[model samples]
Target chain A: MSLDPSFVGRTYPPTAPYQVGREKIREFATAIGATDPAYHDPEAARALGHPDVIAPPTFPVVVTMAASRQIIEDPALGVDYSRVVHGDQRFAYTRPVAAGDELVCVNTIEEVTTRGGHGFLTTRTDVSTAAGEQVVAVWSKIVVRGEA
Target chain B: MELPTQTFRVTRADLVRYAGASGDFNPIHWSDRTATKVGLPGVIAHGMFTMALVGRAVTAWAGAPDAVVDFGVRFTRPVVVPDTDEGTEIEVSAVVKEVTEDGLTRLDVTATCLGEKVLSQARATVRMAR
Candidate 1:
């Protein structure tokens, strides 16, 4: 099924607040095998002028993808997950994510198209704090295989 | 196990195995012909695969994978995997950047591919076990 081109530029409701805990950061770091002290030591992070432990830049993907489900799972959107593969992902940041920040994400369908017999869905998720502090913008592309 | 930093020679074979494991068969990653068509010297490794490796490196330090909360990086330059004489061994290094009262720590990272900065201005946060 073809994605709705009209969905392009459509923005979804903000995600529920996700508390940025220190342990969560560490788990993610561990999962990726990061060993930098700043990822676990406040003094190390403070030496760098940050308020607290800063999360790795790519950390937002956890929440970003969660928020994207609003659109990807929309029955009307026609995106078949089993047939989809990651195409691309990019991140632009205003500042590093710090612990203790209660963040929210707003997902937007940036573009929809068909290429090489695949359905392409591009999305942009803007992440920020509930207090409205801009964190980062994540852009991702997924390709759904042609119907069997 | 005490977390030990790894420094290995990044070979074309290493990159291919990574692509296979990650399910990223992007032509630019393993096909020199495709890379040349796109103006790269040879194959270019997937940015995410590198990121994955970096993540694994950090997580290994923490001794638990699920403890990481967030991680991100910028692709400063492509890590062109040269086929001749084998590929270059890329070096990845990270230092503590910041720590919060909540016991979360952020890391400043640098990854060099063939003596050139491939991933820069990287950051990650990890929560310690309480």
Candidate 2:
């Protein structure tokens, strides 16, 4: 199914705040074999100038994944979820996400196009604190394969 | 300059743990039935998992935690993990692409499974240690 190019530049409302937790950060770090003390120990993180344990760079995916559902599940978008695959992912940060930060995401449809038999959608999610302090920007590109 | 190479073992249990931690219960990462039904060659590792491991390599090379300012990757291929005790392994290596005047170091990274590139256009920029 082809995506509507018109949807490009559309912005969605801010998602509910996702509170970053120390244990969640630890779990994510452990899963990837990242034993950095800043990801697990608060004192260690504080020594590095963080308020608390810091999350791994990719940890924002936990929030943006749910936030993106607004776009992917839009009936008008006509995305066939079964045929979808992650094509690209990117993250740029203003500061590391620390445990106890209430992070919110505002998602935007950066681009929508079709090539051959597939649909490509690019989304940019701006993550910020509830107080509106920007923390990071995450970009995701997904490919919707044509029916076989 | 080339960074030291690192290898990580990915077992079926690791995938399950990652899925739970990352909240990606797509089933394709754990269920062979769901994976094969979806045209996959048995259960596969999550592309994000592979990226996270690469992130570890990048931070290690930078010699600082929380130093990454930019990171990106293209998922070019899947890492198929067989149902065995020793599932599979991914090897991550990188080269310093540039060091900016503003104290940032950029790295071009490569992650491979079974000698086939699984991630392409992989790169990261990190704050140089003070």
What are the iRMS values of all candidates? Answer: 7.6, 0.6
Off by over 4 Å in 2: none
- The residue-by-residue lDDT of candidate 2 on B1-130, one tens digit each, is 9999999999999999999999999999999999999899899999999999999888888889898999999999999999999999999999998999988999999999999999999999999676
Pairs clashing within candidate 2: none
- Candidate with best lDDT: 2
DockQ of 1: 0.08
User: Which candidate has the top score in TM-score?
Assistant: 2
Candidate 1: tens digits of C-alpha lDDT, residues B1-130: 2234455455677667655543456688778887787566788776776776676566655454344655666666777778866676667777776778988777776778767877766666776455
Q: Model 1 scores what on Cα lDDT?
A: 0.72
- Cα lDDT tens digits for candidate 2, A1-148: 6988999999999999998989999999898789999999999999999999998888889889989999999989889998999999999999999999999999999999999889999999999999999999999999999876
Q: Which docking class does model 2 fall in?
A: high
The stretch of ten residues in a row with the least summed lDDT in candidate 1 chain B is B1-10
